[model samples]
Target chain A: MSGYWAGILSILAINIIFAYGIFIPVASGQLNLGGAGFQAVGAYSAGWLSASFGLPVSVTIAFGVIVTGVIGVLIAFPILRTKGVYLVLATFAFAEVIAGAILSSEPLGGAMGISVPGYIDWYVSVIFAGLVTVFVFYLMATRFGLTIRAIHDDEDVSDLMGVSVRNVKVAAFGIGAALTGLSGGLYAHSFSYIEIQGFNALVSIYVLLYVLLGGTQTAWGPLVGATFFTLLPEALRSVLPATKNFLVTLFGETGIVAPPDESWRFVILGALTVLMMVFRPEGLVTRTMVERLQFWRPANRGVTQ
Target chain B: MLLLQQFVNSIMLGSVYVTVAVAFTLTIGILNFLNFTIPTLFMIAGMMGWALSYYGLPLGLSGPLPWPIALMGAVVLTIIASLIVERFTFRYLKTKYGDSTEHAIPLVSSLGFLLVLENLVRIGYGTDSRRFEGPDADLTMNIGGIFVRVPQLVSLAVTVVIVLGLTMMIKHSRIGRGLRAIAENPDAANILGVDTRRIVPVVFILTGLLCGLAGALFAINYGEVSPAMGEDIGTKAIAGMVIGGLGSIWGAVLGGLIVGLIEMMTVHFFGADTVQVMVWGALLLTLLAYPSGLLGHNTIGKGKL
Candidate 1:
């Protein structure tokens, strides 16, 4: 493949992994807006391990994911204590704390950021993304996934049904953190650099948006959402310029007629978000939609067997 | 003396945070909606103010107006944008499914608006910061060995007045009572003749007004405006709002000031790079220790995810 397509595919793969990392907790009735914090932990850990200790790529990646998972479990107790807007604010703060710590830590290269020695080909990311996707799909098919969905539908009812709400939430959060970490490690290795700036609050917001906009009701949400958003700018990269040219032709002469692709993409994203919430707040790949796609009967939608 | 000066400066900075935090707390309090668009509204006011001042009104309506008119125009535009946000996000809160993540719909849509508005501003103007030629940016006064900018003092006074007025409005007025009822229970309030549709937009109006004023003050005092200006201040305001308690007005005031103090002190002691860590760490600690925040009622955001 050409370098351009390779770059886009790699990014697409990383984003998919990251989105799933967020999807797990969200699916379990918790909003993990701290995805970037966990990802930063994973990326920086990989970078630091490879740079300082001369660790291999596999070791660094594993260590990064493990560390983030542990941290996720540790923080989940406090973070999950709050619900709704409070939960969102807490996670958002967590990401900022992580970014701030990295920015000030000398060992992490501070503001200048760190460069990684371990480099991975684009295919590595794609393979990892596919494995992660399958793993999440498999997870959602299990009894554990049912418990999560149960909690997501109604936490009080899930608790009454003896679903171990706390444990399920923590588990989902930790696993999500690990997956996010894996993506971050891939990002670090693929880009051959890791910076604190890359893990800012916007990254967390965008990842959360991807999962929510895709649909939190089913496993298909993250996949479709991530793929669409990852490819959106590239699609716009072609269409926006043409539209701008058309505008120029119609208007004849205007000041500064360059294509406003950067801004247009976000405007489109925002507009879609608004429209989706209004028309399909359940998201694009909701449970009913997924079941319909699977050709399942309406009564069997929530049944295990 | 220098320390005292820092204190005064911190309070001035806190005033901006106070305004924005009040805006945040109000929406979360009354509407139970975490309106992320507040920051964008803040940015919009400042950037549009800059655009109007620098480039004149669009379509050759008039030459670049005076500073006062530009700022007023900015605030008016922000209110309009906020109403537009209300139309999309809050209007769709009541859904048939009644899922756990239903409440997140408005929150997510606001995030979309954040992206849209910020990027739109970036597209209209360049992403770089623009010099805002407001009323005497360098105008300062020395009070008891501490230096204070005239515009900063004016903003601080204005913020105090507006917040106090808002508090009274929410406490004593019939509309205030209706808002409180909605905060208690939207459906009950609607049934009780609170006019949910009409009163709800009032929250957005107040949010827009507060954010717009803060943005204008920021531009006038700092003599700079940028498309990205809102993210930093907005996040800090969120931290303040959470710290003060989500639904409490006075709590936001104290929280905003406290955040400002923390920010200034962190810059003084730990250097500028660690400010994010300190502020966010404080927020994390607060959420863990006192989830309701310093003055938040336990019932405000206790809804299920």
Candidate 2:
């Protein structure tokens, strides 16, 4: 159960990082779905280095972040040439490559993944999540943030306005990817083991969902979304009858009962995203909250619908 | 000689990509959002087929499907699941909060649905992959030493037929013209008396059926299915869709096949491990350089050179 609590906290921290990672690119109007890919690189880097090289967990994490960050820059250099949806496709492809690489790269444990030292705890996760959120909030307030927002609104105009559209997008990708890598490092440090299976494209989608569910505008959306989303299912699992009354009740009463037994989390999440996009693109929190917190507003408030 | 075998293999995989990408293109074009559930649909089809087979209910016993006798029993089952998502999740959100620029909530909620579906399948069936049975099972036939299997051949034929038929319908059929009109200009299409709302459900049903059919074929072709299948297949399809340039149905088909061939060629030339994915990353970079997608109209942001 304590492990569960730790899992919950780690989920929160990872979600925070995931949300911010997505937000930074999105703030500039790019919907890159490759955070999970960067996280995979970082996770594998930390796991492999710590396992084979006997590096300190902290040093391995740093190495992992730096390595993934560099990879992010390399990828960004080519892909950011496209805008909006094209960027999303590029990142999604990037994540898939990472997943396949992890699955095939045996020295890094391939599909089996690798084990690393455990140095992160609940307190550490909480502190990291908080600090990262605060840092991102501040970063979005500066000139750099304003430019990203401007790009998000209108890339051509922003480019004309002297915003280095390409540079800023690349910066967003690199920074967002760094956060994903950091989360991977923390994940390795907390669990002492890592696998491609764990840090998969699905996790990337989950991170995106948490950020979206929490409302991407508010800096705290990731934290709130991660904490609630991760714990909710586990809690539901515990409450369900052994005979699987839960599925019946969930579908009948709530009309969203996940299929019994196998984790219906993916189906549930995917479906929810469609529904949410159609109905409330803003999430539970209003966009005004994000606008009011201008520093956290990676782009201009007036331009956003 | 080996190259010829790989080409066939590539085409077979490319057909699958075509199916999934077509579904995604329709949704994205109409709804103004990328319903990531497209992947889940692929997964669900596999799970459904797996569950039926696991219960000793072979395709022979199931009768030729489309199982219209029971709406939820056949291909229509996918439509039911999709509608459930649209109604409960998307409808609820749309009712609660109107569409805004923020993508966090909808994306996350839909993601939650995806997770739920995945986990439910996992709970019902174990994480291990399962073999497909009956008419859908693998049957090898050596055609000039290429060794075409039942699943692959059947799927390819079905794909060609479906694509051709659908293309005809879209180009000349009454509903097809409207769908195209809507895709071309939604407001204009609506003003011209195209019932966009009615078309939405029809499109969902059509796309879901494709996924379900293709999914079933994939299981039978490989003789094995896994929960992770969706993520991998979806990633490649996404790359195909982008590289071909989204929107045009033909674009998705061509894109999927090209990507499939590229993946196979890479695998044939490079070690089997790196081939399929390495090209995806590189191709994504290539597509990004174009920004209009391989064939899209133009970059959305007007930052074009």
Candidate 3:
């Protein structure tokens, strides 16, 4: 593969894993806006372990995942006490704190960032992404996933029905954090460097956007959302300049046309998000749409809600 | 003596945060929607002010106007942008799935607006920071060995007056009563003839005004404007809003000032690198231990989103 294609694939895989990490919590009725925090924990820990202790790649990645998962569970108990906007704010604050701490910590290399010794091929991340996708799908099919769905539908009623809402939320969040960590570890190895700046608030926002816009209704949402959004920029890269050229010619402008700015891709992404919310707030791949595609199965057989 | 100087400087910095925090608190307080586009609106005012003064109107409509007029024009532009954001984000918040995550539609949409507006600005103007040619911000007054910048003091007074005016407006006006009713219960307020649509836009307009004023003040005080300027100030203000508590104007004021104080003190004690850690750490602790904030009502941001 060309370096460009390989780079794009790696990013696509990382984003998919990251999207699922966020999707798990959203599917369980919580908005984990602190995604970048968890991811950063994973990346930075893996980077630190590899750079400082010279740990093997797999062990470092595992440590990253486990540490982030433990932290997620520990924080989830207190953070989940608030719901809705407070929950969102709490998660956001958590990410900012992580970023800030990482930026200031000396051993972690602070603002200088840490470089990892281990390097991984693009296919490794791709394989991990596939495994994660299957894992989430299987998770969604289990009794635990049913409980999560129940709580997502109505927490008070789910509580009345004897569902352990708090436990389910914390479990989902921990699992999500772990997956996010895994993605971050992969990102560090794949890129061969990790920096705090790479995992800012906007990264959290974008991943959350992918899950939310993809549809929080089913496991298919993040896969489609991540794939589409990750590729959208690359697609736009070619399309935007062409369109600009066409526009310049159409307008009969004799002056030299400046090359298209890179910001247009985000503009399109943002426009898509706004339009999607207006026309299909339920997301692009909703439950009904999925059910409709399964023509062989009886329509009412699995309609839980 | 130096500590006292830092305190005064923090108050000035906090004044800008106070304005933006009020804008953030007002929307969440009344509409129960977290509008992410706020920071972008704040940036718009500053960037627009700079653009208007430096380059005049787009397409050379006229020569560069005076700084004050340019800033006023920027504020007006921001108000219009806020209204447009309201039309797209809040107006389309319809619950189709009747799920907990459905409440996030507007929030998600606002995130979309944030991306769109921010990127468009980046495209229209380069990402580099620009010197804002405003009134001299360096003229200082010495009081008891503490130096105070004159522009910052003026901005501080303006912020105080604006916040006080907003408080009175929300407390005593018929519109304020309507807003309170809506915040209490949107459907009930609609049933009571509150004109939900009309009242909703009022929140956005106020948001625009507050953010615009804050942005303009920031430009004059800091003497710089950039596409990415909003991200730092916006996040800090959010920390202030949360520290003060969501959905409470007074809480936001206290939170904003507290954040500013923390920021300045962190810079004084631990150097500039640790400010983010201190501010966000304070926010995280507040969210975990006291989600209602110091002055916020308990029920404001607790509903399921």
Candidate 4:
């Protein structure tokens, strides 16, 4: 495949992992926005370890995932203490701190970021994506999943019902972080490079968006959200060359005016988000709702309605 | 002296955050949750004023005055933006999900908005920071070997005056008492005929206007405005609100001032880069230890969301 096709696949692959990375916590009634931070640590750890210690790619990836899982477990302590917006804030802060450290610290390769030789390929990323898809699907149907939903609906009631809210939250966080770390490791190798921007807070937002806009109810919501977003703008660029900058800038930081990629992009985009939430908070392609979660009949067409 | 200057600068930075925390607290308290895209109103208003100025619109071309008048014009524009966020985020979330599931949706949609808003600025203003040299006064002076710039000093005073005035207004004024009633219990306020629907948008517009004003003041104090400035400051504001105690108007104000001062003291005592992030980490620890913060709301420990 050409670099463009390969690039698209890699992007999709990473996003799929990211989508699931967010989905695990969110589905369990916890919204963790520190995916990119965990991902970055995993990526950098794997990158640095492989390069410096001459460890095999698989070993470094495993170690990176384990270490990040431990960090996730640590984070869960405070996260479990707070409810709602506070939890999101804690996770967001954690991610920001990690990103800041990555940017300023010299041993972490400073702002330039260390480059890594190709240790993973499109196949590896695709396989990981499959693993996430299968695992989440399976996990969402289990008894533990019911408890997670219970926690999501109401923490106090769940606790009253004998659910270990703290432990479950921690477990969910560890799982999410592990997936993110693995994805990050793959991402570092896929790009053959890593930088501060790779796991900045914005990436966390993007992953959250992927879960939300895709329709967090079923297995397919995140995948669709990630795939569509990752590709739609890129595909539009190739088909409509003149309007590509306009469309992309219309999405990113700069907006469409004169150069079409001006700073107003976010200002208007923010307004548009308000529009989307008001008009269609459910998402473009929602999950087919099946209250039973069985392999039985799929009732609702989308996740929301 | 350089150390002290950076410390002072951080406090100056904190003033803007104080305003933001106040605005955020005011809005959330009234509505219980926000639509997410609201934060962008701050950036959009300031950027609009900048855009108008860039287009050679006279400072007060909206009327027969100066830049401050234009800034108010921007505030009016942001009031519209707040309504927009309301109609979009709230209208749908309320319609589809009810009040309970509203938490994650707004923030996610806002993330989408943030991207668009920041990018709009980047594309419109060329990704580089825009130099905004507002009218300068020779008010900057040295206090105990610490130089406080005129704008910074003015911003500090303005923030204090605004916070104090608003606090008093909220605590004593008819509307203030009504808002307090509504915030304490929207259902009760509604039963007592508070006209919550009216109050919700009013609160949003009021907070948005404050945010716009703060953003303009921020532009003046910082000498340059960048698209990226809002994220970190916005985070700090959230932290301030969390630390000071959510929904406590006085707490928010005090929290902002404390955060500002701590930041300054840290920078003064330690190196700028080292102290800056350390302050956040320290603040997080303090808040965690205290749980609700200096004067924080009670629900943070509940873990309900």
Among these predictions, the greatest lDDT belongs to: 3
Q: Is the docking of candidate 4 incorrect, acceptable, medium or high quality?
A: acceptable
Which regions of candidate 1 are displaced past 4 Å?
Answer: A250-257, A295-305
lDDT score for residue A271 of model 4: 52
* Model 1 C-alpha lDDT per residue in residues A137-214, reported as the tens digit of each score: 999999999999999888999999988999999999999999999999999999999888889888898899899989
Off by over 4 Å in 2: A1-11, A117-122, A153-164, A241-279, A287-305, B29-32, B49-73, B83-110, B125-128, B136-142, B225-227, B266-271, B291-305
Q: Please write out the lDDT profile of model 3 over residues B178-296, one tens digit for every residue.
A: 99999999999999899998898999999999999998999999999999999999999999998888898988999999999999998999899999889988888888888888998
For residues B229-292, could you state the per-residue lDDT of candidate 2 as single tens digits?
Answer: 8977887777777767666667778888988998889877876778646757765666656655
lDDT of 1 by residue, B4-101 (tens): 88899899999999999999999888878888898889999999999999888999989998999999999999899889989888876666767678
What is model 3's native contact fraction? 0.95
Across residues A207-293, which tens digit of lDDT does each residue of candidate 2 receive?
Answer: 766666666554566666666677766665665443366556656765444435535444555555565566656665645765575
Task: Please say which candidate is ahead in TM-score: 1 or 2.
Answer: 1
Per-residue lDDT tens digits of candidate 3, residues A1-305?
99999999999999999999999999989998889999999999888999998989999999999999999999989988889998998899899889988998899989889899999999999999999999999999999999989988999999999999999999999999999999999999999998899999899999999999899989999999999999999998888878888999998886777778888888888999999999998889988899889859875686786
Question: What ranges in model 3 sit over 4 Å off?
Answer: A251-257, A299-305
Error of 1 at A244 (Å): 2.2
DockQ sort, best first: 3, 1, 4, 2
Query: How high is each candidate's TM-score?
Result: 0.97, 0.81, 0.97, 0.87
Higher-DockQ candidate among 3 and 4?
3
RMSD of 3: 1.7
Computed on alpha carbons, the lDDT of every model, listed in order, comes to 0.90, 0.70, 0.92, 0.72
Query: Per-residue lDDT of A1-305 in model 4, one digit per residue for the tens?
Result: 78788888987988998788888888776777778889998898888888787788889888888888888888788766766666776777677778767776877787788988646778788888998888988887898877777776677789999999888888988888888888888888888889877677778877887677776666677887788767765754554545766577677846444433333333443554556666767665544443445576667645696
- Candidate order, TM-score descending: 3, 1, 4, 2
The docking category that best describes candidate 2 is: acceptable
Error of 4 at A88 (Å): 0.9
What is the lDDT for B97 in model 1? Answer: 66
Give the Cα error of residue A101 in candidate 1, in Å. 0.3
